[model samples]
Target: MTKLIGALDQGTTSTRFVIFDDTGAIVTFHQIEFEQHYPHPGWVEHDPFELLDSCRLCIEHAVNKLIKLGYQVSDIEGIGITNQRETTIAWDKKTGQPLYPAIVWSDVRTQNTVDQLSKKSPKGVDALRSICGLPLTTYFSAIKLRWLLDHVPAVAQAREHDRLVFSTVDSWLIFHLTGGLENDGVFVTDVTNASRTMLMDIHSLSWSNESIRFFGFEGIELPQIKSSSCIYGHIKQGALTGFAIAGCLGDQQAALVGQKCFETGTAKNTYGTGCFMLFNLGDAIPPVLSHNGLLTTVAYQLGKDQRPVYALEGSVAVGGSSINWLRDNMHLISDHHQLNELAASVEDTGGVYFVTAFGGLFAPYWKVDARGTICGLTQYTTRAHLARATLEAACYQSKAVLDAMNKDSGTPLRALNVDGGMSNSDLCMQIQANLLGDGVLVTRPKMRETTALGSAIAAGLALGVWKDLNDLDKVNKEGETVFRSQLSAESTERLYSGWQKAVTRSLDWAEPVDEKLE
Candidate 1:
């Protein structure tokens, strides 16, 4: 019987379940798009029940598809989970009920909380960077958790009762999958996810007492941190019952593993709802933190005894979601495919530049006060130019991150392995290559479901289906499309310069206001 692994990819906008054979080829899969709740300006949320139900539905549907293909559920040796990191969830350990809506990672409602915390720290927002590998920003879990405790009465009540359990999406899923309130479900988080919380000591791979006190979360219950690839628990009920849940990783770090970037100096950029670029730094944690606004994060820990791998990550707050903005908000295109078609119709942005700081800029510039801005627009500009500019906005942000990575690493990124939704566009890839300039390559694998494949690999590693990283040599190595610079260095520089100017117009657009916790 062929060994199969199931990977659950719970993301910002959707959830998916994929079953992969031992060779890394996908056998079956199912994806469901869930509702995104925006209660207030700059705030984002999701129904915790809705997220959990979507995962259950995706798993059932995928397993059904696998059965139709004459495969048994027993053929699947284990399961892995990869999720959106820093999206905070609070629940009651006694009843297993969510205290409030999941506070999305993109939500800037905690800006006031961030400001207050920054004031308390002598080093300001960067006081915790040396310990947690993250700044005290609204982009992390600890900040979101802080907001919940300060504002939400239910969360505060749960804490008062000593029933509050705080975790990212991964631990929430694992807890329910293992047993929930009935069986006393295992509550745990992997190093990659914990590293995003601004609560974990990156070097120790454990929760930091200093960070916990700094955030004033001394009494709150945090999930135990574990290796990225290990048997977290097993499904107690459902079609996947008794299957070992072996692996867990944050979505971007999972993409790094999926891309097989095992060597130092290797990197991959995932352009999903947001763009994340991670450059592997190998075994040791760097003593110094990034001065260029990039975050230091754990890449992965394959086993409990294995040494943790580290990375320098650059996050772009907007990526393919900018295309969604053009479609849903501006009504420029009916769908993403139409956006690409319209963009290809235009030669260039026609001197227009768009700064997609919808939730403020991240990486290379932690401008929480920044807002979206479009500059250099003229009467000559059309919908086509706007569409192309939207796409170019993502590419420009990615290039900015790549440049910052080069500066921090002291080595130029020669090639970037690309994946996720935006990478499917040939036009977008060409634009990215054009901006990256000569000698740099952007490679996209034919198997674009790398996020899922990565989790499957992690699961398989723990289950001994594959012994080590070298064992995955032939997995997902079938074929790839490589893109090189098509534009001159002068043109690339000019375009980037305009993008920089547009970004400047976006900074400090929103004034700091005291947000009421209602």
Candidate 2:
């Protein structure tokens, strides 16, 4: 029987099941996009049941396709899961019913919750950073969990009854995949997912009593933290029943692994709905946290006995989503591919700068109040310029993050491994290369299904398909393209300076106002 590996890539907007051969080539896969609920201006949510159903459907569909391609279901070695981090879900442990909708990682409904927590800490928002390596922001899972406990009565009631189980999307999927209520599903999360919860101690790789006490989470059951490439459990019910649930990782960290960035100073920028750049820090825990606006997170832990690798991550709130906004909201283009064509039509942005701070700026500038702004717009600027500016917005933010990463590590990245939706655009990658200047190279792989391949790699390692990291050198290393900077340093700096000025205009644009008459 030909052995294969399966990966479940549960992302912010869609869920996909991919099967990969031994050489890291994609055999068969299925993807399903679910609804995204926007109840309020800044709130984003996903139905917990819908998320689970999507995963199940993706597996069934993909497995059927695999069979059509002359592969038995039993040929699959194991299944790995990679998910969007910090999207908190609470459920009744007894009945396997969700207490509330999953609060997505991008939701900002907890700004007031953030304020309340900051005031209680003597060091303000920076108090927990030393312990958890994350600031007290609305982005982390703990903040979202706190909001659910405070606002949702069902969650509080479950906690009171000692039936509450809280975890990220990975644990949620694992719980059900391994048999939810009937089979006593495994309740565990990996180090990568646990690190984003703001409840785990970064140095110790376990749940912190200090963080739990600070958050006042007394009665809930937290998932046991494990290594990224260890068997959590066996699937009790699925197309691939009896398969080992071997590996798990957050999506961004999975991309880091997929890009084969195992060495220190190696970095990758994933240009998805949002842009995330993670610089690998190897196996040692940092003595200090980021002074720049980057997050210190666990990159991966290959096995239970292996040491954890760390990373410095910088997040940009808007990337390819800006193109979506232009297509959906502004009606600038009917299709996303047109964005590249239109952008290529213009020589440049015509001195225009767009700050895409739609839901507030992330990384280096944790400004929750910052709104989107377009500077240097004039009557001379046309739709082509706006389209070019839209692409430039993401590249500029990435440059900002890369600059911060260089400053914090004191070691500049020589080349960036690029992937995700926006990286498909040759124009966008070229723009990114220009913005990054001559010192850096941007490389994109021909096989762009890297997120899925990453999870498969983890599962394959656990199953002994490959002996170690050294064996993965040629896994996804075919037909690679490298882009070098084409613009002069002086010109790049001038464009970046305009971006900085535009960002300044966007800051504090959404401050709350008291409506009461004096």
Candidate 3:
């Protein structure tokens, strides 16, 4: 049997499993899409048990495919986990029963909590942002943790008894897969994931006492910190018994790591349910931050003296999910793949532009109440026009971020390493380059899921299947698809200016006047 590694990419909307051979190419893959729960208008959640089961199903199905192709399950060498960041989960420490549904990052139900805390503890907020490079928004995990602790009775009860163990998704998976509470199943998170919690110190890369108290919690309630490239725990049982889980990361950080953009000015953009751009900063943290509404974060930490790498991040807040909303809510297309085909059918958007601010604007604009809008629509508009516009909207949002990064960093973008589902579209990459006036490079990964690859890279190195970052880096530098900019200055500027106008028209006009973004 050929040596292979299995990567589990447990994301916001789906769980995907992929096996990569020693030479670094995918031998087989499987994916299982699951349900997203919206219990209330702004409250988003996931069934914890169902989340665990789907991850199992994804791995099992993918392994079965390998078996059918005459590959033994034993051929799998390691497991790496990359998951959605900042979603909070509270569960019984002894029973592994969730005290509440996983509070998804998109859930804005905690807006009041955020605003209340913003006024109640302005100093704490400033300290946290200064140390953590994040704001006291409803989006981070610190406030969400507070929301559950204060509002959910079971959670409050469990916390009082020290029975409620709080964790991000990685901790829950490690707990469940390694025999839950019975086995002392490891409860550790990497620096990348820990950075998003609003609990971690970006400089120290550990749970912060000040922030935890600020969140009204204790550090004892948090997970252990581990290096990104180390054996954090083991899978004590299951289909792949005796296997080690040597890797973990919040999904976006994993994407950045997986892309191998490690130096200053080196960056990556992921086009998943949303679009995110991460710029790597070597050892030093920027004393001053200008977000343009994007977050500045810890890229990763390594070695005995490995200083924390900082990254400036920008999020578009919607990409594939917008296509999903169109199909599910508006019946604009039958499926997501159909969007690619439909978009290619149109020569252009036919004077139409779509600003998919369904959730809100992220990166460059943090208007939480802005709703989606389709502008420049004319009688000539067709489904194909909307489809093209949707795709361009994603690219346009990415460009806006690159522009912002340039402004903040005062350095021009070098080559952008791209990954994620939408990056598969040459049309999207070409459009991205034309507008940004820079080259966009996509990796020819053994698997399309960079999040999982990141996990595997960390895990394998930690487990000694690979020796160190040097060993892993050698593998990642192999082959890449680079899309070069070929657009005239005038045309690109015209399109981008129009996109900005479209975004303006989508702002929270319906929101309370006081809450509106200026």
Candidate 4:
């Protein structure tokens, strides 16, 4: 019988399912986009049920396609999950229903609470950042968790009843897929996912006692901490029945693993709705650096006894999402893909620079109130110019992350492993190389769904279907497009300085700025 690997990719925008054959080629796949909830300005959320349904639909659709092609359902060996890292969900453990909407990673509802906590703490914000490699920012899950417990009535009720359970999306899915806490299976999260929660000790790779106490949570409410590559549980029933639930990691970590970046100094950048750059920093817990908002987090832990891997992450709140804003909010383009073509048409941005600060600046800035801005606009500014500027903005934002990683780690990066939708654009990859003044390695996946492939890598290892990362790396393809920088340091630095100035103006401008696209 042939072997197959299955993965559930639960992202901020949607869920995807994929089946990879023994050679690591994708046999069948499905995807579904789900609804997002924005209760107020600076807030982002999702209905847990809607999120789950999207996964269910994707799984059924993808598997059914393979079955029609004469693939046996029993060929699936293990299931792995990769999810949006910081979205928090509170639910009733017994009834298995969410008490409130899932608070998305991008939401800033807890900014005020974060402020109060920083003021009261002795070492202030710097102290916490030292401990977690994350600043006292509202983008993290801890502040969001605190806010929901305080403001949401149902959440408060369940907490009082000892029936409330909390998790980022990964834990929620595991509970439901494994028949919930009532059915004997319990809640747990992988080290990569747990590190982003802020409630976990980044050094120890466990839930922090001080953090839980600070959040005002008592005993028995927390979930177990598990390795990224281990058997989590089994799906008692679903389209994927009897399959061992083998692997789980946050979306970004999965991307890192999918690229097989096991060695330190290797990194991967995902240019999805947002751009997130992560570097494997080995297991050292370096002290937080000055002013940069970079997060020191768990890259992934293979097992309980294995030494945990660490990483530094830099995130840009809007990447491809800015292109969507151009289409949906400004009506500048008929199709979003026009961005790639339109950008390619322009030799340059023609003096224009777009600061895609839609949800504020993350990693190296940590400011929550920043707004988007398009600078150096003139009568010459056409759609092509703006499109070029948008692409440049994504590259520029990632460059800032690379700069921060250098500061935090003390060694400059030699090259970057790039993936995600934007990485497909050769022009964007060239711009990325020019700005970073380093080589950009673009791995065009045999499967475009690398997020799903990553999950399979993790899950397969845990189920003993795959032995180690070396086993996954054997199937991990090696073909890549390499963009080496030819630009002088003087030229690169000059352009980066201009990008910084444009971002300065974009900050805290909650209202619109007038600049006609002629």
Ranking by lDDT: 1, 2, 4, 3
Q: In candidate 3, residue 109 scores what lDDT? A: 72
Model 1, span 1-518: residue lDDT tens: 67999999999999999999988899999999999998778889999889889999999999999999999888999999999989999988878888899999999988888888999979999989989888888899999998889988999999998999998999999998998879978999999999999999999998999999998887888999999999999899889989999999999999999999999999999999999999998896553468788999999999999999999999999998898888888888999999899999989999999999998999988998999998988999999999999899989999999998888888888999999999999999999999999979999999988998888888999999999999999998888999999899999999899898888999999777455755
Worst ten in a row by lDDT for model 4: 509-518
Compared with the true structure, what per-residue lDDT tens digits does model 2 show for residues 142-209?
A: 99888888888888889889999898999999988998888888889999999999999989999999
Q: RMSD in Å for candidate 4, one decimal?
A: 4.0
For model 4, residues 1-80, the per-residue Cα lDDT tens digits are: 66898999999887889888766788888989888776677678899989877877888898899899998888888788
Estimate candidate 3's RMSD in Å: 3.3
Best by lDDT: 1
Q: Please write out the lDDT profile of model 3 over residues 477-515, one tens digit for every residue.
A: 566677777877888888889998988899865342232
Clash pairs detected, candidate 2: 293-364
Global fold similarity of model 2 (TM-score): 0.97
What TM-score number comes out for model 4? 0.94
Model 1, position 47, has a per-residue lDDT of 91
Regions more than 4 Å wrong, model 1: none
lDDT against true structure, model 1: 0.92
Which 10 successive residues of model 3 have the least lDDT summed? 509-518
lDDT of each: 0.92, 0.90, 0.78, 0.80
